[model samples]
Target: MSDAREPVTGIEVPINLKYEFTAGAALARFLSSIREGRIVGQRCPGCSSVYVPPRGSCSRCGIATEEEVEVSDRGVIESFTIVHIPLPGNPVKPPFIAANILLDGTDMACLHLVSEVPTERVVVGMRVQAVWKPREEWGYTFENIAWFKPVEGA
Candidate 1:
Protein backbone atom coordinates (compact mmCIF):
# COMPACT_ATOMS: atom_id res chain seq x y z
CA MET A 1 0.00 0.00 0.00
CA SER A 2 1.14 3.53 -0.79
CA ASP A 3 1.99 5.90 2.12
CA ALA A 4 0.67 9.18 0.72
CA ARG A 5 -0.72 11.58 3.34
CA GLU A 6 -3.95 13.53 3.05
CA PRO A 7 -3.92 17.31 2.49
CA VAL A 8 -4.53 19.47 5.58
CA THR A 9 -7.58 21.76 5.87
CA GLY A 10 -7.61 25.50 5.07
CA ILE A 11 -7.52 27.97 7.89
CA GLU A 12 -4.61 28.74 10.22
CA VAL A 13 -6.10 30.47 13.22
CA PRO A 14 -4.58 32.90 15.70
CA ILE A 15 -5.39 32.30 19.32
CA ASN A 16 -4.32 33.50 22.76
CA LEU A 17 -2.62 30.55 24.41
CA LYS A 18 -2.57 31.78 28.03
CA TYR A 19 -5.12 31.48 30.81
CA GLU A 20 -5.73 32.28 34.50
CA PHE A 21 -7.28 30.91 37.65
CA THR A 22 -11.07 31.36 37.74
CA ALA A 23 -11.50 30.23 41.36
CA GLY A 24 -11.37 31.50 44.93
CA ALA A 25 -13.92 33.76 46.60
CA ALA A 26 -11.21 36.12 47.81
CA LEU A 27 -9.91 36.72 44.29
CA ALA A 28 -13.41 37.25 42.94
CA ARG A 29 -14.08 39.93 45.52
CA PHE A 30 -10.75 41.58 44.78
CA LEU A 31 -11.48 41.78 41.07
CA SER A 32 -14.85 43.38 41.74
CA SER A 33 -13.13 46.47 43.10
CA ILE A 34 -12.03 47.48 39.60
CA ARG A 35 -15.60 47.65 38.37
CA GLU A 36 -16.44 49.80 41.40
CA GLY A 37 -13.72 52.29 40.39
CA ARG A 38 -11.55 51.73 43.43
CA ILE A 39 -8.05 50.48 44.13
CA VAL A 40 -8.24 47.86 46.90
CA GLY A 41 -5.25 46.50 48.75
CA GLN A 42 -5.04 44.13 51.68
CA ARG A 43 -2.52 44.62 54.44
CA CYS A 44 -0.82 42.03 56.60
CA PRO A 45 -1.32 43.02 60.23
CA GLY A 46 1.61 40.85 61.28
CA CYS A 47 4.15 42.51 59.01
CA SER A 48 2.20 45.58 57.92
CA SER A 49 2.91 44.89 54.28
CA VAL A 50 0.25 45.65 51.66
CA TYR A 51 -0.69 43.88 48.47
CA VAL A 52 -2.46 45.57 45.64
CA PRO A 53 -4.09 42.40 44.29
CA PRO A 54 -5.36 41.83 47.84
CA ARG A 55 -4.38 38.25 48.35
CA GLY A 56 -5.54 36.10 51.27
CA SER A 57 -2.13 35.87 52.91
CA CYS A 58 1.07 37.77 53.34
CA SER A 59 4.27 35.99 52.45
CA ARG A 60 6.58 38.37 54.25
CA CYS A 61 4.64 38.34 57.49
CA GLY A 62 3.68 34.66 57.32
CA ILE A 63 0.06 35.35 58.19
CA ALA A 64 -3.41 35.84 56.77
CA THR A 65 -4.55 39.23 55.53
CA GLU A 66 -8.05 40.70 55.69
CA GLU A 67 -7.76 44.41 56.25
CA GLU A 68 -8.90 45.93 52.99
CA VAL A 69 -7.47 49.36 52.35
CA GLU A 70 -8.70 51.79 49.72
CA VAL A 71 -5.51 52.94 48.01
CA SER A 72 -4.80 56.27 46.38
CA ASP A 73 -4.13 56.81 42.70
CA ARG A 74 -1.03 58.83 43.41
CA GLY A 75 2.25 56.99 43.82
CA VAL A 76 5.99 57.23 43.24
CA ILE A 77 7.72 55.01 40.76
CA GLU A 78 9.76 52.34 42.49
CA SER A 79 10.77 50.70 39.22
CA PHE A 80 9.77 50.90 35.55
CA THR A 81 10.52 49.68 32.06
CA ILE A 82 9.79 50.54 28.43
CA VAL A 83 8.29 47.52 26.75
CA HIS A 84 9.24 46.97 23.14
CA ILE A 85 6.82 44.07 22.62
CA PRO A 86 3.14 43.53 23.32
CA LEU A 87 1.41 41.04 25.55
CA PRO A 88 -1.39 39.05 23.98
CA GLY A 89 -4.66 41.01 24.18
CA ASN A 90 -2.79 44.11 25.35
CA PRO A 91 -4.88 47.16 24.39
CA VAL A 92 -2.01 49.55 24.02
CA LYS A 93 0.67 49.83 21.35
CA PRO A 94 4.23 48.54 21.53
CA PRO A 95 7.13 50.59 23.00
CA PHE A 96 4.63 52.09 25.41
CA ILE A 97 5.12 51.30 29.13
CA ALA A 98 4.97 48.72 31.89
CA ALA A 99 5.76 50.02 35.36
CA ASN A 100 5.81 48.76 38.93
CA ILE A 101 3.50 51.28 40.60
CA LEU A 102 4.00 51.55 44.35
CA LEU A 103 0.75 53.05 45.61
CA ASP A 104 1.20 56.11 47.85
CA GLY A 105 -0.15 54.66 51.08
CA THR A 106 1.21 51.13 50.83
CA ASP A 107 4.51 49.26 50.83
CA MET A 108 3.60 47.34 47.72
CA ALA A 109 4.43 47.54 44.06
CA CYS A 110 1.94 46.56 41.37
CA LEU A 111 2.59 46.40 37.63
CA HIS A 112 0.65 49.03 35.70
CA LEU A 113 0.64 51.12 32.56
CA VAL A 114 2.21 54.54 32.18
CA SER A 115 0.82 57.08 29.76
CA GLU A 116 0.54 60.76 28.74
CA VAL A 117 4.33 61.18 28.83
CA PRO A 118 7.06 60.20 26.47
CA THR A 119 9.01 57.11 27.42
CA GLU A 120 12.25 59.11 27.51
CA ARG A 121 10.97 61.29 30.35
CA VAL A 122 9.89 58.56 32.73
CA VAL A 123 12.25 58.70 35.70
CA VAL A 124 12.69 56.19 38.49
CA GLY A 125 11.38 58.47 41.23
CA MET A 126 8.86 60.55 39.31
CA ARG A 127 5.40 60.89 40.84
CA VAL A 128 2.38 59.69 38.92
CA GLN A 129 -1.35 59.21 39.32
CA ALA A 130 -3.98 56.94 37.89
CA VAL A 131 -5.65 58.26 34.77
CA TRP A 132 -8.94 56.43 34.85
CA LYS A 133 -11.14 55.85 31.87
CA PRO A 134 -14.81 56.73 31.70
CA ARG A 135 -17.16 54.88 34.08
CA GLU A 136 -18.79 53.04 31.18
CA GLU A 137 -15.53 51.26 30.39
CA TRP A 138 -14.74 50.00 33.89
CA GLY A 139 -13.96 46.30 34.23
CA TYR A 140 -12.40 43.66 36.49
CA THR A 141 -8.83 44.25 35.32
CA PHE A 142 -6.03 46.80 35.43
CA GLU A 143 -7.41 48.27 32.21
CA ASN A 144 -10.25 49.60 34.35
CA ILE A 145 -7.89 52.39 35.24
CA ALA A 146 -6.61 53.75 31.95
CA TRP A 147 -2.97 54.46 32.82
CA PHE A 148 -0.65 56.42 35.12
CA LYS A 149 0.38 59.92 34.13
CA PRO A 150 2.91 62.36 35.50
CA VAL A 151 1.54 64.34 38.43
CA GLU A 152 0.27 67.65 37.13
CA GLY A 153 2.66 70.64 37.45
CA ALA A 154 5.33 68.34 38.76
Candidate 2:
Protein backbone atom coordinates (compact mmCIF):
# COMPACT_ATOMS: atom_id res chain seq x y z
CA MET A 1 0.00 0.00 0.00
CA SER A 2 1.25 3.47 -0.92
CA ASP A 3 1.98 5.80 1.96
CA ALA A 4 0.13 8.63 0.14
CA ARG A 5 -3.69 8.58 0.27
CA GLU A 6 -5.99 9.61 -2.59
CA PRO A 7 -7.56 13.07 -2.33
CA VAL A 8 -11.29 13.04 -1.75
CA THR A 9 -13.55 14.93 -4.12
CA GLY A 10 -17.11 16.02 -3.62
CA ILE A 11 -20.00 16.80 -5.95
CA GLU A 12 -22.80 19.22 -5.33
CA VAL A 13 -26.34 17.83 -5.39
CA PRO A 14 -28.85 20.59 -5.86
CA ILE A 15 -32.18 20.12 -4.13
CA ASN A 16 -35.31 22.04 -4.99
CA LEU A 17 -38.52 22.00 -2.98
CA LYS A 18 -41.93 22.98 -4.33
CA TYR A 19 -45.25 22.86 -2.59
CA GLU A 20 -48.67 24.49 -2.59
CA PHE A 21 -49.67 26.33 0.55
CA THR A 22 -53.32 26.54 1.49
CA ALA A 23 -53.96 29.61 3.62
CA GLY A 24 -56.64 29.60 6.27
CA ALA A 25 -59.40 32.19 6.16
CA ALA A 26 -57.63 34.67 8.39
CA LEU A 27 -54.35 34.34 6.53
CA ALA A 28 -56.16 34.57 3.22
CA ARG A 29 -57.63 37.92 4.24
CA PHE A 30 -54.21 39.21 5.26
CA LEU A 31 -52.61 38.15 1.99
CA SER A 32 -55.41 39.68 0.00
CA SER A 33 -54.99 43.00 1.79
CA ILE A 34 -51.25 42.90 1.16
CA ARG A 35 -51.89 42.58 -2.56
CA GLU A 36 -53.92 45.77 -2.39
CA GLY A 37 -51.13 47.72 -0.70
CA ARG A 38 -52.86 47.57 2.65
CA ILE A 39 -51.61 46.05 5.86
CA VAL A 40 -54.35 44.43 7.86
CA GLY A 41 -54.33 42.67 11.20
CA GLN A 42 -56.82 40.75 13.26
CA ARG A 43 -57.98 41.96 16.66
CA CYS A 44 -58.52 39.49 19.47
CA PRO A 45 -61.93 40.09 20.95
CA GLY A 46 -60.79 39.01 24.38
CA CYS A 47 -57.67 41.12 24.81
CA SER A 48 -58.03 43.51 21.89
CA SER A 49 -54.47 42.76 20.85
CA VAL A 50 -53.80 43.16 17.16
CA TYR A 51 -51.77 40.70 15.13
CA VAL A 52 -50.33 41.43 11.75
CA PRO A 53 -50.16 38.63 9.23
CA PRO A 54 -52.79 37.47 11.67
CA ARG A 55 -52.61 33.80 12.63
CA GLY A 56 -56.37 33.47 13.04
CA SER A 57 -56.16 33.38 16.84
CA CYS A 58 -54.76 35.36 19.70
CA SER A 59 -51.79 33.68 21.35
CA ARG A 60 -52.38 35.53 24.60
CA CYS A 61 -56.13 35.09 25.07
CA GLY A 62 -56.53 31.91 23.03
CA ILE A 63 -59.50 33.28 21.15
CA ALA A 64 -60.30 33.61 17.45
CA THR A 65 -59.22 36.89 15.81
CA GLU A 66 -61.93 37.97 13.43
CA GLU A 67 -61.93 41.79 13.38
CA GLU A 68 -59.70 43.09 10.61
CA VAL A 69 -57.77 46.19 11.57
CA GLU A 70 -55.76 48.32 9.17
CA VAL A 71 -52.37 49.16 10.52
CA SER A 72 -50.07 51.95 9.45
CA ASP A 73 -47.37 51.13 6.92
CA ARG A 74 -44.94 53.17 8.94
CA GLY A 75 -43.57 51.59 12.11
CA VAL A 76 -40.84 51.62 14.67
CA ILE A 77 -37.98 49.17 14.73
CA GLU A 78 -38.06 47.23 17.96
CA SER A 79 -34.82 45.41 17.24
CA PHE A 80 -32.53 44.55 14.35
CA THR A 81 -29.40 42.84 13.14
CA ILE A 82 -26.84 43.66 10.46
CA VAL A 83 -26.51 40.52 8.33
CA HIS A 84 -23.13 39.81 6.84
CA ILE A 85 -23.61 36.21 5.73
CA PRO A 86 -25.22 35.34 2.44
CA LEU A 87 -28.37 33.23 2.35
CA PRO A 88 -28.93 30.94 -0.60
CA GLY A 89 -31.71 32.12 -2.95
CA ASN A 90 -31.85 35.52 -1.24
CA PRO A 91 -31.52 38.28 -3.78
CA VAL A 92 -30.47 40.90 -1.27
CA LYS A 93 -26.71 41.00 -0.75
CA PRO A 94 -24.92 40.93 2.57
CA PRO A 95 -24.64 43.88 4.95
CA PHE A 96 -28.38 44.20 5.15
CA ILE A 97 -30.51 45.11 8.16
CA ALA A 98 -33.14 42.63 9.31
CA ALA A 99 -35.47 44.17 11.84
CA ASN A 100 -38.48 43.41 13.95
CA ILE A 101 -40.86 46.26 13.30
CA LEU A 102 -43.72 47.31 15.55
CA LEU A 103 -46.20 48.87 13.18
CA ASP A 104 -48.42 51.59 14.53
CA GLY A 105 -51.62 50.22 16.13
CA THR A 106 -50.36 46.63 16.27
CA ASP A 107 -49.30 44.76 19.36
CA MET A 108 -46.87 42.33 17.70
CA ALA A 109 -43.73 43.01 15.75
CA CYS A 110 -43.09 41.60 12.30
CA LEU A 111 -39.71 40.74 10.83
CA HIS A 112 -38.70 42.52 7.65
CA LEU A 113 -35.77 43.98 5.81
CA VAL A 114 -34.78 47.61 6.38
CA SER A 115 -33.04 49.33 3.52
CA GLU A 116 -32.22 52.71 1.90
CA VAL A 117 -30.43 53.77 5.08
CA PRO A 118 -26.98 53.14 6.42
CA THR A 119 -26.79 49.92 8.41
CA GLU A 120 -25.07 51.68 11.28
CA ARG A 121 -27.92 54.16 11.48
CA VAL A 122 -30.49 51.48 12.19
CA VAL A 123 -31.53 51.45 15.83
CA VAL A 124 -34.34 50.53 18.12
CA GLY A 125 -37.23 53.00 17.87
CA MET A 126 -36.09 54.13 14.44
CA ARG A 127 -39.12 55.04 12.35
CA VAL A 128 -39.50 53.20 9.04
CA GLN A 129 -42.07 52.88 6.29
CA ALA A 130 -42.85 50.23 3.76
CA VAL A 131 -41.16 50.65 0.40
CA TRP A 132 -43.63 48.88 -1.80
CA LYS A 133 -43.01 47.44 -5.22
CA PRO A 134 -44.77 49.02 -8.16
CA ARG A 135 -48.49 48.37 -8.35
CA GLU A 136 -48.03 46.46 -11.60
CA GLU A 137 -46.02 43.82 -9.80
CA TRP A 138 -48.52 43.38 -6.98
CA GLY A 139 -49.21 39.79 -6.05
CA TYR A 140 -50.70 37.68 -3.27
CA THR A 141 -47.45 37.76 -1.28
CA PHE A 142 -45.64 39.74 1.36
CA GLU A 143 -43.05 40.50 -1.30
CA ASN A 144 -45.46 43.18 -2.40
CA ILE A 145 -43.61 45.40 0.01
CA ALA A 146 -40.08 45.14 -1.30
CA TRP A 147 -38.68 46.29 2.01
CA PHE A 148 -38.93 48.94 4.69
CA LYS A 149 -36.86 52.09 4.91
CA PRO A 150 -36.33 54.90 7.35
CA VAL A 151 -39.15 57.37 7.04
CA GLU A 152 -37.98 60.87 6.19
CA GLY A 153 -38.71 63.57 8.78
CA ALA A 154 -39.84 60.87 11.16
Candidate 3:
Protein backbone atom coordinates (compact mmCIF):
# COMPACT_ATOMS: atom_id res chain seq x y z
CA MET A 1 0.00 0.00 0.00
CA SER A 2 1.14 3.60 -0.72
CA ASP A 3 0.86 6.46 1.74
CA ALA A 4 -0.41 9.95 0.82
CA ARG A 5 1.07 13.16 2.17
CA GLU A 6 -0.96 15.92 3.85
CA PRO A 7 -0.66 19.59 2.89
CA VAL A 8 0.80 21.98 5.47
CA THR A 9 0.02 25.69 5.78
CA GLY A 10 0.79 28.55 8.19
CA ILE A 11 -0.02 32.23 8.62
CA GLU A 12 2.51 34.84 7.52
CA VAL A 13 3.80 36.68 10.55
CA PRO A 14 5.41 40.08 10.00
CA ILE A 15 7.68 41.74 12.53
CA ASN A 16 7.77 45.56 12.53
CA LEU A 17 9.72 46.58 15.56
CA LYS A 18 11.74 49.78 15.40
CA TYR A 19 15.11 49.61 17.08
CA GLU A 20 18.62 51.05 16.77
CA PHE A 21 21.93 49.30 17.33
CA THR A 22 25.04 51.24 18.30
CA ALA A 23 28.50 49.86 17.57
CA GLY A 24 30.72 50.64 20.50
CA ALA A 25 34.21 52.21 20.33
CA ALA A 26 36.32 49.59 18.56
CA LEU A 27 33.64 48.52 16.11
CA ALA A 28 32.71 52.10 15.35
CA ARG A 29 36.29 52.86 14.32
CA PHE A 30 36.48 49.74 12.18
CA LEU A 31 33.31 50.62 10.31
CA SER A 32 34.51 54.17 9.82
CA SER A 33 37.66 52.86 8.19
CA ILE A 34 35.64 50.64 5.86
CA ARG A 35 33.60 53.65 4.82
CA GLU A 36 36.83 55.31 3.77
CA GLY A 37 37.76 52.33 1.57
CA ARG A 38 40.24 50.98 4.10
CA ILE A 39 40.33 48.08 6.55
CA VAL A 40 41.67 48.34 10.06
CA GLY A 41 42.31 45.67 12.66
CA GLN A 42 43.12 45.95 16.33
CA ARG A 43 46.25 44.24 17.63
CA CYS A 44 46.38 42.45 20.96
CA PRO A 45 49.65 43.56 22.53
CA GLY A 46 49.70 40.53 24.79
CA CYS A 47 49.20 37.75 22.22
CA SER A 48 49.69 39.80 19.03
CA SER A 49 46.56 38.50 17.37
CA VAL A 50 44.97 40.90 14.92
CA TYR A 51 41.21 40.92 14.55
CA VAL A 52 39.45 42.36 11.52
CA PRO A 53 36.22 44.14 12.40
CA PRO A 54 38.27 44.95 15.47
CA ARG A 55 37.14 43.40 18.71
CA GLY A 56 37.83 45.57 21.70
CA SER A 57 39.75 42.82 23.43
CA CYS A 58 41.79 39.73 22.67
CA SER A 59 40.03 36.38 22.79
CA ARG A 60 43.15 34.43 23.78
CA CYS A 61 44.92 36.69 26.24
CA GLY A 62 41.79 38.46 27.54
CA ILE A 63 43.61 41.79 27.23
CA ALA A 64 42.28 44.94 25.58
CA THR A 65 43.54 45.57 22.04
CA GLU A 66 44.48 49.19 21.41
CA GLU A 67 46.73 49.55 18.35
CA GLU A 68 44.86 50.15 15.10
CA VAL A 69 46.60 48.37 12.25
CA GLU A 70 45.76 48.83 8.59
CA VAL A 71 45.26 45.51 6.81
CA SER A 72 45.66 44.66 3.15
CA ASP A 73 42.48 44.64 1.06
CA ARG A 74 43.53 41.42 -0.61
CA GLY A 75 43.52 38.04 1.11
CA VAL A 76 43.26 34.29 0.56
CA ILE A 77 39.95 32.54 0.91
CA GLU A 78 40.49 30.14 3.80
CA SER A 79 37.08 28.54 3.22
CA PHE A 80 33.89 29.07 1.23
CA THR A 81 30.60 27.61 0.06
CA ILE A 82 28.37 28.14 -2.99
CA VAL A 83 24.86 28.86 -1.78
CA HIS A 84 21.96 27.69 -3.94
CA ILE A 85 19.04 28.28 -1.60
CA PRO A 86 17.00 31.47 -1.62
CA LEU A 87 15.93 33.34 1.49
CA PRO A 88 13.98 36.50 2.26
CA GLY A 89 16.05 39.71 2.58
CA ASN A 90 19.22 38.11 1.23
CA PRO A 91 21.62 40.85 0.08
CA VAL A 92 22.54 38.86 -3.02
CA LYS A 93 20.53 36.57 -5.24
CA PRO A 94 20.75 32.80 -5.01
CA PRO A 95 23.66 30.76 -6.37
CA PHE A 96 26.29 33.01 -4.87
CA ILE A 97 29.46 32.23 -2.94
CA ALA A 98 30.00 33.10 0.71
CA ALA A 99 33.59 33.04 1.89
CA ASN A 100 35.75 33.26 4.97
CA ILE A 101 38.84 35.36 4.14
CA LEU A 102 42.01 36.03 6.08
CA LEU A 103 43.03 39.59 5.25
CA ASP A 104 46.79 40.07 4.88
CA GLY A 105 48.60 40.92 8.12
CA THR A 106 45.61 39.90 10.20
CA ASP A 107 45.28 36.79 12.36
CA MET A 108 41.50 36.25 12.04
CA ALA A 109 39.10 35.71 9.18
CA CYS A 110 36.04 37.75 8.25
CA LEU A 111 32.97 36.41 6.48
CA HIS A 112 31.58 38.19 3.42
CA LEU A 113 30.11 37.58 -0.02
CA VAL A 114 32.40 36.62 -2.88
CA SER A 115 31.37 37.48 -6.43
CA GLU A 116 32.61 38.55 -9.90
CA VAL A 117 33.63 34.94 -10.49
CA PRO A 118 31.65 31.80 -11.24
CA THR A 119 30.63 29.79 -8.20
CA GLU A 120 32.32 26.71 -9.60
CA ARG A 121 35.63 28.54 -9.74
CA VAL A 122 35.68 29.61 -6.09
CA VAL A 123 38.00 27.65 -3.83
CA VAL A 124 39.89 27.77 -0.56
CA GLY A 125 43.20 29.72 -1.09
CA MET A 126 41.78 31.77 -3.96
CA ARG A 127 43.07 35.34 -3.69
CA VAL A 128 40.34 38.00 -3.56
CA GLN A 129 40.07 41.73 -2.97
CA ALA A 130 37.40 44.06 -1.70
CA VAL A 131 35.17 45.74 -4.29
CA TRP A 132 33.92 48.89 -2.70
CA LYS A 133 30.88 50.83 -3.76
CA PRO A 134 31.12 54.42 -4.99
CA ARG A 135 32.55 56.84 -2.45
CA GLU A 136 29.21 58.66 -2.17
CA GLU A 137 27.46 55.45 -1.14
CA TRP A 138 29.68 54.64 1.79
CA GLY A 139 28.59 54.89 5.42
CA TYR A 140 29.80 53.62 8.77
CA THR A 141 28.76 50.07 7.96
CA PHE A 142 29.79 46.85 6.27
CA GLU A 143 27.74 47.93 3.25
CA ASN A 144 30.62 50.19 2.29
CA ILE A 145 32.45 47.29 0.69
CA ALA A 146 29.87 45.98 -1.74
CA TRP A 147 31.51 42.53 -1.97
CA PHE A 148 34.82 40.79 -2.67
CA LYS A 149 36.03 39.65 -6.07
CA PRO A 150 38.95 37.68 -7.40
CA VAL A 151 42.15 39.73 -7.56
CA GLU A 152 43.38 40.36 -11.06
CA GLY A 153 46.69 38.67 -11.97
CA ALA A 154 46.68 36.62 -8.79
What's the candidate order when arranged by decreasing lDDT?
A: 2, 3, 1
Residues 1-154, model 2: lDDT tens digits: 6658667688789998898989999999999999999999999999999999899999999888899999999999999999999999899999998999999999999999999998878889999999999999999998899999999998
TM-score of each predicted structure versus truth: 0.82, 0.90, 0.88
- For 28-84, candidate 1 gives per-residue lDDT tens digits of 667798789887888888988878877788888778888888889889888998989
- Per-residue lDDT tens digits for candidate 3, residues 3-107, read 586655666889888879888799999988987888998999998899998989999998899999999988999999888998778858889888999999999
Q: What lDDT does candidate 2 reach at residue 58?
A: 98
Which whole-number lDDT from 0 to 100 does residue 133 have in model 3? 91
Q: lDDT value for candidate 3?
A: 0.90
Number of the top TM-score candidate: 2
Candidate lDDT values, in order: 0.84, 0.93, 0.90
RMSD (Cα, Å) for all candidates, in order, is 4.4, 2.5, 4.6
Model 2, CA-based lDDT: 0.93
In the predicted model 2, the residue pairs found to clash are none
At residue 62, give the lDDT of candidate 3.
89
